[model samples]
Target: MSSAPTPSRSVIHGDALEWLAAHPGTPGASLLTSLPDKAELGLPIERWRPFFQQAASLCLQAVDEEGLCVFFQTDNREQGRWVSKAGLVLAAAAELGVPLLWHKIVLRRPAGSRSMGRPGYSHLLAFSARATVPAEASSPDVLPELGELPWSHGMGLAAAEESLRTIRRASPSTRLLLAPFCGHGTALEVANRHGLDALGIERNRKRAERARGDR
Candidate 1:
């Protein structure tokens, strides 16, 4: 059997957007990240569009022509309105002229108890500076979402791992992975698990430390 990918070995404590702006990334690097949910930021959804646009722009600036960006996001509904974080990111990518390669659904089964209109799914969006190459194992358009692992409220480890695998399968030439809003480093940990070089930036010091602990 093939050996497992290398471990995620680095973590940075800072804001992802700022970090991206301060330190440029090499070409062919892949970005795997999940921005803070709309509710978590305590900001109105109306204010999120510009923020995501600037964030995407900074990330695009860091990568090369062949770089790929994989975004993991879920719905955030408040007061009966579902806020589409993925949509905003997509718009941001389009604004930057990045071609949207593919988008996949991650289906989740409700645990504990069910509520009215609560969704049991998330989205994984992939974009590239240019066209992307598909992999045989990465052809699935929808994947089963993984269970949460002691998560304080972020992307699931299993889900993140599978998404990273898919991204790598599509772009095997990508050498490094960047996560600007790494939150708790789920993406970074998954990157390391795949033995890919990765860097994660989180503004929350505690979350950043916890991300390292996940390793």
Candidate 2:
């Protein structure tokens, strides 16, 4: 039998907290929402409280010992901070060692917007994390994506893959789809051509202009 080295973990997370807090109450995530499982290290998920108690608690201890969660979502701490609009919660947990469950979500505006443009979208790769578990949280059947983008690189990509890897082993029937149909031109065509069953959503029209970056 061959044994391979274990992969490093990360989470590619967006500042869901910043985006959601921008709005008082938005139904998109407000109605029947809960914490999600299967969070990757590079890309932080929507900060589902109580649901991620185990990981969140561990994250708090790591932050307390290391001065920060080391979210691993991005190299640019500033950009990641923008996504982790609720950094204070994580910071508090680190300081007190008492985890605090978060509001479950903090959404940002769509990509390519400045200062909560749509009040529900953002381009920053920030994080929305919690320290404790929530009573309303539930486990997700499928792994969630960070920034919900089409790129296969960066902290988010690393994070997503890590989560998917674990999930595949735990439940082989569940599959992870990347960059599901988000780009124009040969990108989507390529996904179809390869029979890889690309998984991503691209509602933004400007994505068409990003043909050069498509792989």
Candidate 3:
């Protein structure tokens, strides 16, 4: 009997960055997309702190463990201390020999452009991981539901396809993990379109049971 080859530890941490810093070669994901139109720093900035907190905590922790780390953000705000966070995250990753993938997922909703009976939000996944390959070509994270993120809850420009393409071109070997509701599965498909391995993970016990019953 042949044993299954162990997949490299592609640590896909979900809301667990605090503990993932110790793990080697774990890339990070950005949640923020962009600042609201006419948005300015101040109270709104308070909300962004959590983003920095999570990134800082993970980076610092990674340093202590002599592990590698990456900081990925989606917020497109180039003002205030956001740039500082990027510098700090990059510095920490460099010190620990960790690579970071920082890319933006662009979206575009042209009123009648969305699918799934929802406002059509074109998915454009982007990021950069300082690993062997570019982080642009990534697979799905949660099956057809990449990231397991509900379509209703998905946020972004919904039309950043162009930006995503740029990221893919920058790094053509990165795999994208996706889920069933994986942000239109565009990123996974994008990676696949670009000759990258795209993977999907889904928590579909209920659906699987229903399918078996029907069968």
Q: Each candidate's TM vs. the true structure? A: 0.83, 0.24, 0.33
Per-residue accuracy of model 3 over 1-215 as CA lDDT, tens digit each: 99744322122213334233444233332111211111322446557556555445453342212112222233333443223344434454466444444333223343435244322222322233332333545544211212423233332222323333444444333333222212233334433444434332222343223212222
Cα displacement (Å) at residue 112, model 2: 31
The per-prediction CA RMSD against the true structure, in angstroms, equals 3.6, 16.3, 10.9
Each candidate's lDDT (Cα)? 0.73, 0.29, 0.33
Top-down TM-score ranking: 1, 3, 2
The residue-level lDDT of candidate 2 at 58 comes to 37
Off by over 4 Å in 3: 1-48, 51-150, 155-160, 175-186, 199-215
Model 1 vs. true fold: TM: 0.83
Show the colliding residue pairs in model 1. Answer: 5-194, 5-195, 6-195, 7-192, 8-192
Candidate 3, run of 10 with poorest lDDT = 29-38
Candidate 1 has its poorest 10 consecutive residues by lDDT at 110-119
Supply candidate 3's per-residue lDDT for 207: 28
Score candidate 2 by TM-score against the native.
0.24
lDDT of 1 by residue, 124-209 (tens): 88887764765556566777655575565577776777767766777778778887777777787778767788877888888888
Please give the range of 10 consecutive residues that has the lowest summed lDDT in model 2.
26-35
lDDT of 2 by residue, 1-215 (tens): 98644322111123323322343222111010111222323344444433244333333332211111222222112334443423433554455444332222222334345552213421221122322223343333322334344443222332333333322332233222223122332222332332223222233344433432333
